[model samples]
Target: MMTQLLKVVPEPQAILRAWMPFKSVVGVTSVRTADDYVQARATVDALVDEIRADEDHPLADVLDYLGEQVKRYEDVHFTIPEAQPREVLRFLMEQHDLKQEDLADCAPQSRISDILNGKRAISKDIAKKLARRFNVHADLFL
Candidate 1:
């Protein structure tokens, strides 16, 4: 005669007990300080380097979660003044030490100068190229 074995399922809290340690190990906690935000940002940058634009990457959710945490901290502590798209572009250009000619990959120097001077607006195609070059969201240029 053979004895049959029974499988036991752990309770929800017990499952969480096993998960919390792993979560803390990966630094997945609420950002409450500048140090916490820095750590979260580092984790997000690392995740981006690993995941790139692959939505199917295993760490995509982790990146999203950490990104949200970083955004939350910034929303509370760092409020960016709203500005027009051209003004934003100018500010980014200054910050990056870029000139109209430096944006040749995004647009013609004349077009870049026009946009910076408020004589013309940024088109969607140029906005996409600028976003890629600046490593920022295209909506910033829009």
Candidate 2:
């Protein structure tokens, strides 16, 4: 029995079309050092945020691929140190564009200010409310 081989060469136009979105992600599909990896990581983060904003986004695969590249680079070069609860709280506040007054339902504005300034510890009930408000784990506030 003779085995038959099918030639499956991709069309040039199709290849170009597929490559169009990848123009900004120069590092993911190639070997990269620390600097390029950082740049790619930032690009991937922005792309992920953009994709997450749309429920039926057409760029999901691109986001997934970018995430994988970021994970790979992070596995080799990234070191994340544990942050204090206050720092985490501040980060969440910044991410949500929240001021102390915005968290009034969670706590008094003065208490929120004290927590941010490290003058007060995050209380259990306040942590729970904050967790719900920020949509993050309560332990982050704890």
Candidate 3:
């Protein structure tokens, strides 16, 4: 015997209906230029503030769409300055609450400590491994 967990999804038409009214109300569109991008980002922040304890409010999808627009604009226009490998490593470790031993799959604990402490440079091979483990671009570690 197996236990099954079922979840309900809103139908396409229902989702479209829910989205239609708010589109005009919020004035969201495909963000093509900088001004539109800024407006959409502001809209996303406003929507985030508006949504209270109810996580399932119908406006969640609109919030998601707005966030996607901001991300698309950033991908095209914004470039993150290259960071030192050790800074990147330290940031990832702190952000993820990981310790040196946690990354032993990528290298020995001592090597990880050395990399994080800037005593060693990250080789291309180790960069690739770290990128895969952290789910980030390899260039971030280079």
lDDT of 2 by residue, 41-100 (tens): 566556544553353678766655655665576557654347888898888677547688
Worst 10 residues of 1 by lDDT: 128-137
Report the number of the highest-lDDT candidate: 1
Off by over 4 Å in 2: 1-81
TM-score of each: 0.57, 0.44, 0.44
Candidate 3 regions exceeding 4 Å error are 1-81
Error of 2 at 18 (Å): 35
lDDT accuracy of residue 109 in candidate 1: 99
How many pairs of residues collide in each model? 0, 0, 0
lDDT of 3 at 16: 94
Model 1 clashing residue pairs (backbone)? none
Range of the 10 consecutive residues with the lowest summed lDDT in candidate 3? 46-55
**Candidate with best TM-score:** 1
lDDT of 3 by residue, 26-102 (tens): 77677898788777867865665565324498887776677677768777887555688789888877755779987
